[model samples]
Target: MEKYTHLGVYGVLVRDDHILLIQKARGPHKGKWDLPGGSIEFGEEPELTLQREFIEETGLAPITGNIRTAVSYTIIYQYDVNQMEELHHIGIIYDVELLDDQAVLRTDGDGQDSLGAKWIPLETLGLLPLTPFVEMIMEPAVQEESDVGMGTEVEG
Candidate 1:
């Protein structure tokens, strides 16, 4: 039998010349910089889930741009307080743009949901350590925002 897996949705919200990222205040990569996104519901569309997750996690409502890439990444994440170590997920990352920066910020969950969000310079993205898959998908596109298109080359 195959190991159980979890599906996730992520939006890369960029605004005011900065990208919005959530600080992982708990679990796996705690305190890591990454796009604002989360798991998609059973009957939810990936794009719709992205919009909701972005707002819930970052307090920023955004219009998702073309998919930057669909990346498969592995993580042995521990869920629940028991730390039994059974949960695993391959995250899906997407490209997102914020329509406005004048939005409000609110904490999402009680603990470890990484309710903290911030807008950081686009050029500083390379300075932070991220999941290998995220780094791989974002590197080139970060430098060429104007090049992204339905007709442009993208990886899945």
Candidate 2:
């Protein structure tokens, strides 16, 4: 059986009551809403990867700060329908912030992987077609707010 491992880094940009998200245009999660980040290049630091990805996907620079690694997880999926190749995806999630709140959307650079980036309301996240990783990452945050009865008020 063919097998491969894909390592990716993602940024979570929460501002006000919204979170930045990209509508994937390619890959296994195409057509789904996901965080604005992508695969880590060889010899690249995870932090740099997150920053580069943010610029590539959203056309906005990430505000330099204490980028915190929030979580890491793995997902398994079929890479090939006929060859039985399995893809093991390892994801790193980071909490990040953008330099500007009103950055206009751009479709250049690595944005080809996605339709575009936009701010999604946190309250309506449950209604979007999100990738499994995004859904998993947001669950705790949602639960925490509900547990405290504070509602969704995402803050940077």
* Candidate number with greatest TM-score: 2
TM-score of candidate 2 against the unseen true structure: 0.79
Instruction: For candidate 1, list the clashing residue pairs, or say none.
Output: none
Error of 2 at 42 (Å): 1.8
lDDT of 1 by residue, 1-156 (tens): 124566787777665567767777765667676666777898998889888877677666656655666766555555555554544566667777656657675545325456477777766778886655557666765756534533565544
Q: For residue 39, give model 1's deviation from the true position in Å.
A: 0.6
The residue-by-residue lDDT of candidate 2 on 77-117, one tens digit each, is: 45456555456666788777667767666654354787888
For candidate 1, give the lDDT. Answer: 0.66
Q: What is the C-alpha lDDT of each candidate?
A: 0.66, 0.75
